[model samples]
Target: MFHISYTVEGTWRLLKRQGWSWQQPARRAIERDDSAVEVWKKETWPRVRAVRRSATPGSSLRMKPDSR
Candidate 1:
């Protein structure tokens, strides 16, 4: 019983790390929180990829701004 519980908890933690959204619309969890999580994602996600690219060395090529 203990081993089963431990395994289940470990799997859930791993899934959480993999971006499993408990606040998914189908889960009804986001509604109770007044959709704060969803709204935050809307405001935050836009720059995530850009920020990552800026942080990576040689991730982008420097070209003349007007280069076709």
Candidate 2:
């Protein structure tokens, strides 16, 4: 180490002077499949969203049965 002290403000100023700026990371993973996403949106998501509560008569939200 050269024993150089740098503050956050000073480092940002130096970066800006060198034509660099902070940027947000990409929202999606690099391994994301665009075609798969499109297929899911077209073929699966609508059917999933259209399913009504009455269609699932056997399903329950309760984690445990109520005590009598």
In candidate 2, position 7 carries an lDDT of 98
Question: Over the stretch 13-44, how does candidate 1's per-residue lDDT look in tens digits?
Answer: 98899988466455664437657768767886
For residue 29, give model 1's deviation from the true position in Å: 20
lDDT of 1 at 12: 85
Highest TM-score, which number?
Answer: 2
lDDT of 2 by residue, 1-68 (tens): 89999999999999999999899876988999999999999999998896555654564565776679
TM per candidate comes to: 0.23, 0.40
Backbone clashes in model 2, listed as residue pairs:
none
Question: What ranges in model 2 sit over 4 Å off?
Answer: 31-68
Q: Look at candidate 1 and tell me the lDDT of residue 1.
A: 45
Clash count for each candidate, listed in order shown: 0, 0
